[model samples]
Target: MGAARVTRRGFLLGGAALLALPGTALAATAPEIADCAAWGARPNSRVVNVVVQRPVKILVHHTATPNVTDLSRGAADALARGIQNFHMDRRGWLDSGQHFTISRGGFVLEGRHRSLEALRNGRKQVEGAHCTGQNLVSIGIENEGTYMDTEPTGVLWDRLREMCAYICGQYGIAPTEIYGHRDFKDTLCPGDVLYGMLPRLRGEVGGMLGQRLEGSSVRAASWPVLREDDRGPVVEAAQRLLRGAGRTEVAVDGTFSAAMAESVRVFQAEHATEEVNGIIGGESWPLLAAPVQAGDGGEAAEAVETLAATSSTRPPSRVGPEQWQQLLTAAR
Candidate 1:
């Protein structure tokens, strides 16, 4: 097989180019992927957007489907088709929301169009619809079953580890960059059990790629970093927190302006007392936001409900207390 002639900037086909992704020397082995056609995917409602940048992170999600006894290739194929239809028809997406999917049977299949090609090239990405605020920079992998309390099968776990190593190798991403869906959004996606297992997943993938995942944590949840120019519900959550903390000057708008940045830095100075970079990442989020439980009032409570209300297709308190606890745990 001819190696893709890939450069940091573009891909040239049918040349013996080095496939070692930028900033890494490890040779990535592309796994046997069942592309969209192989899984009998419906023609995309429209062309998938292929972005010209390597993804920096991997987001794991579960289909929230039943944990069935049947674990077969046929089931995997059916699952792929079902996902495409739901994303296209119901969610009104061009194709499946994720870049790839792993079935309970441990079959690895491509989800969105151009995703396999992008992976093979190792320097481009297909924009995903998986996480609202993070689709542009992350690759989403949907595991096949609901895993809130139950763990995935042994085969499923092994296959997921292999795929993560492959993706990390291909994209030159560190194992620490692997995160669960709930990290970025206010929803229970890659459920409790699977989310908790991410540290093990990162460690295993790092071992496979002969790489080190520095700064590893029990969960190492990657919250979307909010800078001055960033926008959306997470930013609003921060703003509301500031407003509630007596920064009456801060408005509960969904935009992260320069004033907000200064406010964040000031808050960090007063409370967090380190990494006063004015960015809401692992270092500052837990300090800025608090979890809201039943009948809770004040800005923290309002901010949690604001995130819930802002997220379409989820319940009123979809970004509920359980997920907030998980975030605080992982970030700390």
Candidate 2:
């Protein structure tokens, strides 16, 4: 709606001004990106939220589109336009939900409208809807194709590594900070094959950035985000913890309701400084929960058993040796 906002990296002048200017070397090193206009996106009618803080992490997603044989640039452009249409018309988003996308043909394209300009400047970020809770604070890159079983083509892999390196370098994010969609949500998105490659992806990105990630950082964990209207065994697990924390109003029935929300607020009030929004995340999760194991009993054991009964595909749903403590602290 307005002239491209001036950025700290210099007057953007235009896209062709990517040559490394004095004091703007980092800005010049951004990977080539086709902006929304290049792919014929609709006019973004809604306000796009911008943040001054650099994103702390990169999230990888797969389009879940069929693994088609067409690897042409035209197909990539068409894919971008199709995604934008679906996001705006079907999903009711302002524009595309993700910050960027990489086609199977290795064409890197900007998803959200201003993402390319922001990435070039590296001082601002476009808040996205790519992931539920962490969208405002992280960059999401959707790689085209469902990698549930098959590996991505070598060209696509090379482009992914380059794009990740550029984003990490510009944002000052650690290579180990890269993660898959499933890390924050309870979905098989990005597929098992792609999700499994995250550690190796991190290591390779680290190599490109000259930063070696240790095994611990490589194995870093983030708990699932339980939002409104969502239901699962994990919700039941959290409900048990809420009951132990003295919010008896929360029913351990594997459903997220207003009562469970109220209980979550009270729990946060007691153990955390977070806003009483009833959302459970890293900040409150560790503070409310302690450690639970196979021998552990009481509400904590029941919580673990409930989560353990969740889908067998998810490793966390299993009551393994290192069962995350969900109710021990509250039960105390």
Most accurate candidate by lDDT: 1
lDDT of each: 0.75, 0.73
lDDT against true structure, model 1: 0.75
Tell me how far the alpha carbon of residue 228 in candidate 1 is from the true structure, in angstroms, after superposition: 32
Q: Which segments of candidate 2 are over 4 A away from where they belong? A: 1-29, 222-296, 302-332
lDDT of 2 by residue, 1-332 (tens): 12444544344444332222233233323456788888888888798998888899999999999987899889999999999999999989999999999999999998998887677668789989898888878999999999989998887888888888777766777778898876665456788789778888888777665565777566554555565676877777777777766777788788888777777777877764435677765455555454555467767567766655553322243343234632221221
By TM-score, how accurate is candidate 1?
0.65
TM-score of 2: 0.66
